[model samples]
Target: MIKLEQINKYYSLEEETLHVLKDVNFEIKEKEFVAVMGPSGSGKSTLINLIGFIDKKFEGKYLFEEKEITDFSDKELSAIRNKSVGFVFQNFSLIENNTVFENIELPLLYNGSAYTDTKARVQEVLTKVGLADKASKYPKQLSGGQQQRVAIARSIVNSPRFIIADEPTGALDSKTSEDIMQLFQDLNRQEGVTIILVTHNPEMVSYCDRLIRVKDGVIVEEELVK
Candidate 1:
């Protein structure tokens, strides 16, 4: 469903140029759970940003389901991003003041859903993430795992083509992390949600179908996980 060809990205820092992604090439098929592993300076994050339509200034071709992403206008790209990608982060990124239902409803509202009509969809995703009862609670009132579950609910409430999860379990305890990972696995295996995970935790890799390891702005390994 996604393809990158001869992708290269660079940054201009003062007087010197730094390469961020070097001739990266890969494709992620539909419903696949892929993990990207790399050190701090590696270009995994940059690679995902490009895939998720957040970065457009790169030397390469990106094709999503055979359509060229570079062909879209900024507004069109934003629309495509809103409709085609969901993002999860290490820090959850929920609104502190919004109720769980409110947080999950934001994307639908951005897509022009009426505020009055968002409850059913919000409740559906909340149930999918196992937080149906917590819909009226604020982020501060939830445990870390529940908070992250809310974040996951928010991401999938829009039903994007794929999810980009970057260090999703970083803040939780190990047991909580396992629970979150299991939830992710269930999402992938049962619901067929395509997921691209960027994590430093090797234990997390075990849950994925494939692994791609990056180093110094290059992909050094790509293989199916056993």
Candidate 2:
């Protein structure tokens, strides 16, 4: 479970301090698929960063799995990001020169895994994402949908509890986006991985169990779709 209470975030500028998130309170239960929707600059990305453990500077009480976030050590936080959370961005963040297998192996390498283990895990995720045959190809050789599949493969190789996707289908066509959303749904329902997606597309948001809508730095609505 994840809960945020009275969360507030701000950015400092030479002339002004821009408040980005305000009193953002919400609860995401285990195995729930949630979508965060808003227009540009609505703190959607900021909210994703916070949930993904990519941002540490903020004011609020953040509790994850019944533990207070601020009490965790740096190493523990790193473990949370590595072992408990996965992230997929709008832009597929795969390495340009690396083969698909190598890109998926990167996270395990960062986690200090042995070469044999990394290869096994990468191959497993490749098969899971239906890209087992393209492991030898580079990012430039794959289409947008394929590249995003590679990104998703890399994200799940760690078997994270929370898959935080920020506009994951933003760069794809409608058909391809539907495929990706279906994949997310499969992961949530079958694997029971809790998903928090940040997207502007209602078509995409409709795939989720609930929508947490934001506007001008505040949560304006939350609706359950399923």
Candidate 3:
């Protein structure tokens, strides 16, 4: 569903140019659960941002379902991103003051969805992520795992075709992390949402159907385990 060719990202600092990604090329198919593994400075997060349409300054062609999006206008990018992509971050990114229901409802609100439809979608996703009971609770009232679930619910509330998760379980304990992985697995299998996750944990890699390892900003290895 996504492809990148000859991708190169460079940053200029003090008259010195630092290349973040060099000749990075990869493709992710629909409904595929792919894991991106790499050490620090390996450009894993940068690549995710590119795929998620958060970074547009890189030199390369990014095609989503055969349409080149590299030169898409900011408004166009925002539309596509809101409708086609969902994001789960390590920090949870939930609004502290909003209730779980409200946080998950924010996306639909931004998309101009009808109030009734937005309410239903938020409830459905919250239930899907096992956060229905916590709908009225604030972020601070929930545990780390519950907060993460709320974040996941918020991402998928719009039924995005793809999910880009960066260190999704980084702040959770082992058991909670496993639960989150299982939730992602179920989402990919049942909902057919293509999931691309960046993780440093070996255990998380084992849960993915395919693994891609990056070193020095290049994909050095790719393996299909399923």
Q: What's the lDDT of the predicted structure labeled candidate 1?
A: 0.94
What TM-score, to 2 decimals, does candidate 1 have? 0.99
RMSD values for the candidates in order, in angstroms, are 0.7, 1.2, 0.9
Which ranges in model 2 have alpha carbons more than 4 Å from their true place? none
List the candidate 3 regions with Cα displacement exceeding 4 Å. none
Per-model TM against the reference: 0.99, 0.96, 0.97
How many clashes in candidate 1?
0
How are the candidates ranked when ordered by TM-score, highest leading? 1, 3, 2
Q: lDDT of each structure?
A: 0.94, 0.90, 0.91
Clashes of each: 0, 0, 0
Model 2, residue pairs in steric clash? none
- Scanning candidate 1 in windows of ten residues, the lowest lDDT window is 39-48
lDDT of 3 at 30: 95
Model 2, position 184, has a per-residue lDDT of 88
